[model samples]
Target: MAQTGSTYTKCRQVGTTSYNKHMFLNSECMSAIDCAIMCKEVATCTAFTYDDLTKTCRLYQKIETINCELNKENGGITFTKETECHVNWETCGNSCYFYEGTTRRTLDEAIEYCISQGGYLAEVTDEEELDLVNSMIKGSVLLGCTLYDGYWQGRTSGQKLVFNDTMWAPNEPRGQGHKCIQIWKDHGKFDDISCLGIGDIICEKVSILRFHFIVTKASDL
Candidate 1:
């Protein structure tokens, strides 16, 4: 209901529901956005209800079929966690990634393309992320890593490139004048290549949906 920062996605409203017995946590919040934040902080919180009039937020640990029922009153709005991400995005670990296979672009063009899709070039900070990204690529895929003035840096966040010894394949980065890095789908290793080389693009961003509830007349309920 409330839009805040752009890093994380918002929560969606599920209309007024009767779930008095399903409540597990109760706290005071200034608005539905505050309540949603509180719910996200708790790993067990699956759903929540915020009372606009009383400024109270109720969280549910688990949602069951019996816990939901249509209500005519406009006292509160229910927010539920969306299980599925948006179309064309794949859920991997805690983040969502979209791979563009239709078009190939240079390193600079790929970075711009990812930004235009509400995301940045995918950043691999750890082995798990690296493995996940490698699994998604069919062949060679462009990464966020770039060589700037002889120093490797992540183009997405400008972070220094740090990798384990095993991350780079033996005798890799063999090409001269290669400034951009790409991951091999066969071995999940990094290889420095020319920035002019066109490859598939991968975009990473938060995936969430926010929906607001609408209260109708008592007769309509």
Candidate 2:
């Protein structure tokens, strides 16, 4: 059965194309196996989802988008652009990370970009997504967000923010837009904020199935 939780962004096909049987991907994050393994271990991982927003993997579940870049030369982990990645909760720490930028954006716009990159807004639900979000929470970085529309509060219309587990401060959202969440320098820790706010975002890799083994198994079957 297909899981139901979040709604990721998808293109509307402005024009016609030769074929509709194509998948686009980018060179980012750790291997897809790593992401899958992590998601499998993370109980909150409802969908090992990938947002075509920016052609990147949104490991966590949030209502906003992230623009991340790999550490040109992280300590010694020389992960290449072509490396596959998985979003399973257990592998959050092991998977590669992109430098989620510190730019303010609207919630709708943010999510749109994330979809273009092949991932979706963060989806924090249980301890798994919680720990994952906090791990990436850093200076000038916004964790899970709740824009003016209040989407990340775990409840929009009737949908609940299933796996989210973070604390929030009262009377935040100082932005004129007062939409995007932000972590002020004076703020205490990870909590709900606005989307127009600026902060570092986290992303992962989308796994690609190794069809060779599947093909072999099918033949044997």
Highest TM-score scorer? 1
TM-score of 1: 0.54
lDDT of 1 by residue, 1-221 (tens): 01124421343333333355554665767778878776665545667767778776776766552144335353345577643457878765445788887787888898899889988888665677777777777777888877787677877566676667677767876758888888776677888788888888888876564434444344655
Number of colliding residue pairs in model 1: 2
Query: Lowest-scoring 10 consecutive residues by lDDT in candidate 1?
Result: 1-10
- What lDDT would candidate 2 get against the real structure? 0.36
- Summarize candidate 2's per-residue lDDT along 10-116 as a digit string, tens digits: 21212222212422222232444444443433333322323333333323222121111112212111112222354432233223323256664555654555556
Task: Tell me each candidate's RMSD, in Å, in order.
Answer: 8.3, 16.7
The top-ranked prediction according to lDDT is 1
Backbone clashes under 3 angstroms, per model: 2, 56
